[model samples]
Target: MQQLRTPHVVVVMGVAGTGKTTIGPLLAARLGVPYAEGDDFHPQANIDKMSAGVPLDDADRWPWLDAIGAWAHGRAGLGGVVSSSALKRSYRDRLRAAAPGVVFVHLTGDRALIEDRMSHRQGHFMPTALLDSQFATLQPLQPDEAGVAVDVTGSPEEITARAVQALDALSRPAK
Candidate 1:
């Protein structure tokens, strides 16, 4: 039971099929915190657009990002975990503006691996066709950002374990 940025929320981020949904709950459960699925926050319009193989523009995303940010704001101080395909610096910034001190765990994998997973996925609105747009738009976590990048080359459990360990280590007091 380590305090991972006590009073902060963990945003598990990455492109489609990168395991944000899969790993986010594991993170929340491991931390004994509440879990939020990012997809659940999407507006119907957004879903319809992606389902049609259309990529969402920034304009389309702002309101959605803000909504998720609002959720993060609500969870602030209580410490929680949520998943979002927070692909750009601006998106991450927006969430941070809402919930100060929010940290990120960015799951990453190569396009081939991600595509394979995306193809095998069932009932998800996001089409594999838009994965290129996701990758094109992704801006990896930068230095000075309160976050960590995790490679998704392992099983979900391994990824979750790594995320929990990394986050817990981060929140520990400096020697």
Candidate 2:
């Protein structure tokens, strides 16, 4: 397995059904790092709301983001992968504040494709009805962010390979 040049926490971020849950572990395995499921950090109330097809507002997300941030902060310099919706710039900023050197992998795909995936998936708290809110809230990675945008159009392994390649590029020093 390959490893990151530096042990920075990798946050696999995207809207629901973009495969963050599926790809995070695969990417972590490929990079020889530990994986954390983002949903595990959510409070039951937040989960319950989403399960009812209610979209979370910032008020509902702060605690959850803080929890995930704490986990990322703890894993700093140890190389770990965690998945999260991380929809907004402010959310990513908050995460960066907690874990300074953390990087992100923003998964991208067509809405129809994502909705299809969500509809077919089972046992997830997030419902397909809230997908529009997810997409609306998303702010893609900016030029200054220490990360890469990867397409989620292929098999998990294929997507993982693309993410690995993108992350490797990010790790390279500018000439």
For residue 60, model 2's alpha carbon misses the true position, in angstroms, by 0.8
lDDT of 2 by residue, 1-175 (tens): 1223488899999999999999999999998999999999999999999999999899999999999999999998788999998989899999989998889999999999999999999888889999999998999988877888999998999999999999988787775
Pairs of colliding residues, candidate 2: none
Model 1 lDDT per residue over 54-73, tens place: 99999889988888899899
Which candidate's TM-score is highest?
2
Error of 1 at 83 (Å): 0.8
Q: What is the lDDT of every predicted structure here?
A: 0.90, 0.91
TM-scores for candidates 1 onward, in order: 0.95, 0.96
By TM-score, how accurate is candidate 1?
0.95
